[model samples]
Target chain A: MIVIDTWLYGELASYAGEDAQPGFAQLKIELPDGATMQDLLDEIDLPTELRGITFINGNLSAMPGKQHDLTQELKDQDRVALFHLRSMWPYQYRQGAAMLDSFNDEIQKDGDRGIHHAFNG
Target chain B: MWFLRINMKDRTHQLTEVPEKYKKLAGRSLTSNLIADEVPPLAHPLGPNNKLVFSPGFVTGTSAPSSSRISVGGKSPLTGGIKESNAGTPWAWKLGRMRIKALIVEGQPEDKGEFWGLVIGLDKETGQPTLEWFDATEFTGQDAYDVYPMVFKKFEGRRVSVCGIGMASEHAYGNAGVIFEDMSQNPSRFAGRGGLGSVMGSKGLKFILLDDAGAPGVEIADKELFDEGRKKLAAALNEHAITKPKGGLNTYGTAVLVNILNEAGGLPTRNFSRGRFENAAKIAGEAIFDGVKERLGEERYNHACSPGCIIRCSNTWYRKDKSEHVSCVEYESDWAFGANLEIDDLDTISELVKLCNGYGLDTIETGVTLGVAMEAGVLPFGDGEAAIEMVHKMGKGEPIGRILGSGTGTAGKILGVVRTPAVKGQGMPAYEPRAVKGIGITYATSTMGADHTAGYTIAPEILAVMDDLDPLSKEGKIALSRAFQATTAFIDTSGHCLFIAFAILDIASGYQGMIDEVNGVLGTKWTADDILELGTEVLRVERKFNEAAGIGKQADRIPEFMHTEPLPPHNVVFEIDEETLDKVYGEL
Candidate 1:
């Protein structure tokens, strides 16, 4: 048996267990050995119309969207984060920090032809 | 398209051909370019030398969604720099439909203290907007809460889109703003920053009412191409998780951000004393939603503030008597009045927002000013009622009220509080810079003073939309904030609401659609590079203007307290190096 700890956000929290609070749900999925991410999603009975971003072991599970990548196997004590209809922002703005080159790589990963505008120094 | 120049110096107005250089400008770009070119950079903001200009966005008045933003610009009395504050109101669409490219109000009237109004509408014969002057003595000295309804009644026949400076502006308060209507025509939306309204009031112009009924709307060169782009953009908005039906914003409005930021440990509390508010849940979007659902009637929640905005993340607050208490309460306003002041009650926060709206004050500025006063021992931190009373006293012109009305930095100076949370003389927003490090780059470097809207790095830093750049790490934010500011500068000129960034950032079709729509209308082809160039040009013009105004890299900094005083929860201080900060405008 494999147990995956998951945190669900927005409306996706309903399919999961009780939430600690809004946008923070604590639940564990008990999956049979060799069960894939899709199998776990199916067990959770998540809505098909619902599109979301998932994090497995603290990394993005799907690049394009959803849990359709069924071959990815679940593991014991893995951390999974499911977010549906959630958009985070500065509840007007939070600041500080420095600049990095990886920032441009992350922008490219967002898929809209990465916009990491640079200034000529 | 024509530029309507109103010379208050001689009580005359003229419609002239737009200068060739300014033919393609709109919104912030248009306003900044004009101010940089025409107005003296060193002119006193409230003096006759400063010119106040109003312009609709390039994409306004057409089938474009959320394109009804109107930018009001001039020398900022608050920042003493070139300023442009925008609002989502029907007046922008009205002006666009009337084929007016820009409306310029220049020079102070000889009788600067007298009240006056400018009425503009489509001429029956000419089918273009013409200006008419009127004596508005009756509504003189009244706050926007009292005067907006009167203007609505007086121009009921013309279906005029009205917005005006209020008593705070009449007092020439630097913290004042211009207030206008939502879709329901309640004067709730505002161009609420840098005190441009005071500039208008200084010119003795109390009200500006525009009517575009029976006039041709925006001229689109390629109708089919434009339609395709509009449809693509709308579809993206409808499909996005945040912008679509039953989205977090749609369900609870922008105040929903409270929990998200709280969980991130970035919500400022008690005037930058802490990053996380202990009672943040009390004013969270879910709590506000539950209140609206339990207390307010239908037709009050999930309302639209602009003519054709799809997101409609605005809501109204109603009292037990079922009377509307406030028109639209947003997240920053809620955070400013609620957590920043240690006022936990959502109802009281909404009431305080209404109080600022009534007085025509910037809620962020008002809250920051009040926070300074509280730090200085003017009032107790948790006293919501006292805060309300102090804002109400703004129009009375009392010494205390004037000090408060002047803004946060001034209030802090008078009260001997060095911990004023401001940059470039403008008060900080709800976000705590120390905790969310990326936005510190924005506050320290934005052309506009402490303006989050100038460069909303929240999407990448906090939301993890495009990139999950660590909010705590100071490595990637300079490039990140510069990108956001440039993209946002381009978006601001497009006339669409900044909220559309959610769609454009993630969806390729949406980004392409935004480009196509502008290209279709103007009959010009532009790529991402061209778009970046345009934004850079606008920033350069603004930078030059600020330089001439004597505000330079030395003034582009966060408050000193942010450097020495560490915010709690994260226990972080804003430490982005000044050398990196200077690089934000390096290209320009």
Candidate 2:
């Protein structure tokens, strides 16, 4: 199961229940005996441009390709955190091709392949 | 016709006449046009080639209420582009009464001499400008009273206006601003932006004094016509709940917006990362007021930004420990330093305000720069003491300090911060443009660089005066933003306090009648059409300049995060399409 928090601004908050609760929602997943992280993304409705720099318990981890191997080990109690956008400038999305090009090398350096090795085993 | 020309090289001076064409442009319009014409865009901002100018607005000399505005213009060390920032203060009213439309100080001296000041006075009857130079060391570490009276004594009760810089400017720091003494003899008012102080220092001028003793009063074509319009306009404002006597603004000042915006959840925090901050109540208007009342024991918490301002949305803050904090701790500054930096301590924010004031910098830009530095981990977020120390470093012209002082754009580059929240090399104010879509258009399109006050679409879009439109919807926003932008350019050029926009928009004929009064004063026939045209022209000129400067087209954009990170509370992203943004400039 995965949980997400949404904090709206100005007048929009009225739309949420006045109690200001997290308005929790959950998604349940069933994986093949050996599934991968990329498979999890393929199942969700997240924006395509959101990639790079995933944090697990506040510590940045290896690439999605390597992290995907964890899909098999995932259970009902596991937690997943995602950052939709990498760049901070507001208004536009779609990280520039140049930005993505460099980020690929960073993912490899951060041991994305090793994370995949864990799930693959 | 008298003008004083100080040859900075030799510490010598001459008196001259105001050119005919320049007589029309005053305040921001005059100063900006002057800089654009005279200054080469590529010239080093702090070099001798750049000129410094201070001018009052078109209606500044008239007895119209709240018409006093002072404009400062020079090459901006912060933006590396032409910058003009106007501030409202009683000094403008006093100066305007002397019949001085503008003051121009130009050229550096032959010898690289020590710092010197100049005083220019009128000949009482002849109204000719006279120049006197002050000793270089007399004004160091002194307040306006200490230094100003000495210069005024030279004029002998001539009712002069004194414009000078403090120690911060003499060092030629990029963030340095020039202080103008108000009628109350307080030096708190400043023409603070764009490092105009650097331009003054570059010209080797420490001060430019205006003495209008012999000058005639500003001419009005028809007294009856002007008065009728003025009375109606004034009544509209006076009767309004917002602008009237002892209204919300009167009690709380601009700090009133702190709670309202926070309640809306648009109060930015943690360097624009989050929409809400837990510390809003601590630094809110009511809290700020209570703090002052307990500490100062005075009923006078509110003060007018300028003379004749009926809406007193400005205040003097006192530390809880019973010491002077800063006069006029505006809402934007409160958000920029307090909530944005994750520093909820009001006293610390006050200290930062004082630091910017004495050092001669824009509080918004300086605070935003510090926030960007925090984002880069140059300093930890919410380190209020470190922020104050960094500002002090700027006063002394330290290298890292210079980068921070230059503004958020350069600071982000220097520190390698990816979360550089800015538009066109200038920092955004308190409102997260994504939250307020209409204001977002303004942040993208304003020629002055990401300034919210540049064009306020919030009134029409959110407040819903003429039409109640969903703020989240993108329909009619382009037209709304353009209309508001055009109207604001006219308002700024007219030298009227922008808060008046609220009253004017609400009252059917209030805005038009004010325009009529200005026409009556100027001896010209102008209707609403003329005012709108003037605004359009100003925008056109700005767009042309930006296009020529190569910041056009591609430069107008919101950052990538807005599109991807669906802001919390409302899952809505910035729905305004990029194609629509380009259409805004289509007419231009």
Candidate 3:
């Protein structure tokens, strides 16, 4: 088994059950080896639509209306943070920052090169 | 319609008709142009030759939503360059309604130790602007929070608003900010950057009070067109997710960016040594919202900073006993004291913010200076109580307090700290340039030193200015940043809040509405393309002034530490070459 240290922020903190604090919740979930992000979401019972911004080990993996990280496999002892829909990261503030290869590809394929305040997919 | 000039050297004033050249300009464009035309470039920033000018935006005082913005411009004592700092408040709305195009304060009193207040109102019989001078010596060397209410009470029977400086300005601190009264009469709103307040203080001016009773409101040249434009922009503001009622900003405030930037590893922490703070969530907007609910026994949304603002994003922090501690704990202020100092408690951060407000200091500059002081071992990181003591010293004008009050770059040099995060003598804000390259380019090239608002692109259509270029490439990003800077200049001149960019960028009609409103007021035909050109002209004038003042292109480069040190998590250095940095202004 592999352990994943996960953080839930804002309203999504309720997903951690009794471990939830006022603004955030942290949990160490024991996941079977080779489990993917989808499997971890199923374990926490969090719908993909509820997550706005997601990070895996400090690299942006997903944003609102963009959820390419669901199928990405999780690694052992990885740090994952999930934020609710109210969260936002403006394009200028995030431009040229680190992101997953799949996420980068998804952003580049957009018509305006992803120069938007929010993506409502 | 009139340029109200107050000569401090003689304690006299004059009202001149607005020149044809300046009739079309307002806000930043008007202030920068007036300074360029009147003031000598080589004059001392705090000397008699330097002039401080204030002007409202184009649509200000009209029924336009979120239009009560005032731009204050002068040669900066901090950057030693041309500077325009702005804020939104009822004072701006009153000034616009009085039909004063620009209020210019020039010359200096020989007895610099004394201060005087100026009362401005409209004459009931002549329908002309009037000015009255009063002794304000007793109000000097005191907290602005205490002074503001007294001024309001003295003018209790009349409709009035106040603007003044605090102890920071009286001491001639480089981080001093010009304080304006918010809706609640708190001296919380500020034209808070570039040390313009010190310039006012140097002139022996303490406050400027406006009483706009029986004054004419802003005249719209084309009422029908103006109403059409106003409705379009208002509808866009109401419909957008980030700006609508109960939207992200209204619900959580600007501090919502804390966690998002932390997740992206772009949040500058520990004197720019790291990219992420472990305790960021504790001081974030989400935590503020929840913490307030827990303390107050109810859920409270944010309130507007100005009178007509719809996208109310200003938040207040309450004490444990359900009393208000401060009116706002913004993102830059929160990050500067929280992650930058490695202090995460909201109470400590809010206390520091309130102290800066009371002292009339720019919170970003104060916090950044503290971060550098922490790195020098003056105080240890995460020492909240120690930080509070240091801020009190600043308010008291202690020796060490004066050193830190000289701003981030000077404090870094005085304390012998090597890793200073400054550009052109001004401290960088919350964003880490190493992790975010585009903003890095902006920080390097903006006429204003390291300003985040210098290049804010609202809509994708404005990206059309960079036709056929690949935005992913280095050259493409430079072009995009240039276009953004130009469009932002126009928005600043239009007198609308930058938050309107969020809605206008998504809704095309909203963008048109902004232009239409400007045209309706000014009675001119201006298209989207004309906006880019007009904004470009503003930048050109500012660059020319800075160059003549000896802060040429060489001073536009980023700090040496940013280019050498690697930020954590992402571990990226600012790799954009020098030649590319030159292209931001070179192509213009």
The best candidate by lDDT is 3
What is the Cα-based TM-score of model 1? 0.86
On residues B1-588, what C-alpha lDDT tens digit does candidate 2 reach at each position? 233445576766665556777655566666667777777766777776677767666666666666777777777765566666777876666556656666666667665446676665556567665667766566665434456666666667656676778656766655567887654555667766656776786676777666555656566677777777777778767866556766556666676556444534466678877766766757766567656766777655476767777777777787666766677788888888988899888889888887776666677878888888888887888888898888778766788777887777777778887777777777778876655566777778777777767764212222332254332235456655676677677777777777776566556466656776777776778767676667777677666655655667677877666666665433446656778888677755
CA lDDT for candidate 3: 0.90
- CA lDDT, candidate 3, residue B581: 89
lDDT of each: 0.76, 0.62, 0.90
Question: Once superposed on the true structure, which residue ranges of model 3 sit more than 4 Å away at CA?
Answer: none
Q: What is the lDDT of candidate 1?
A: 0.76
Per model, how much of the real contact set is kept? 0.33, 0.00, 0.69
Tell me how candidate 2 scores on lDDT: 0.62
By lDDT, the candidates rank as: 3, 1, 2
Chain B TM-score in each of the candidates: 0.96, 0.90, 0.99
Choose 1 or 3, whichever is better by TM-score.
3
Mark the regions of model 2 whose C-alpha exceeds 4 Å error after superposition: A1-121, B1-23, B110-114, B137-158, B296-298, B321-323, B457-475, B569-575
Model 3 chain B TM at: 0.99
Cα lDDT tens digits, model 3, B1-588, are: 779999999889999889999999999999999999989999899999999999999998888988899999999988888999999999999988888889999999999788999999899998798888889998887888888888888888988899999899988888999999999999999999989999999999999999998889887899889999999999998888788888889988999999888878889999999999999989999999999999999988999999788899999999999999998999999999999999989999999999999999999999999999999999999999999999999989999999999899899999999998888889999899998888888888888898888888777876786777777689888998888888888888989999999889888898889888999999988999899999999999999999999988898788888888888887889988899889889898
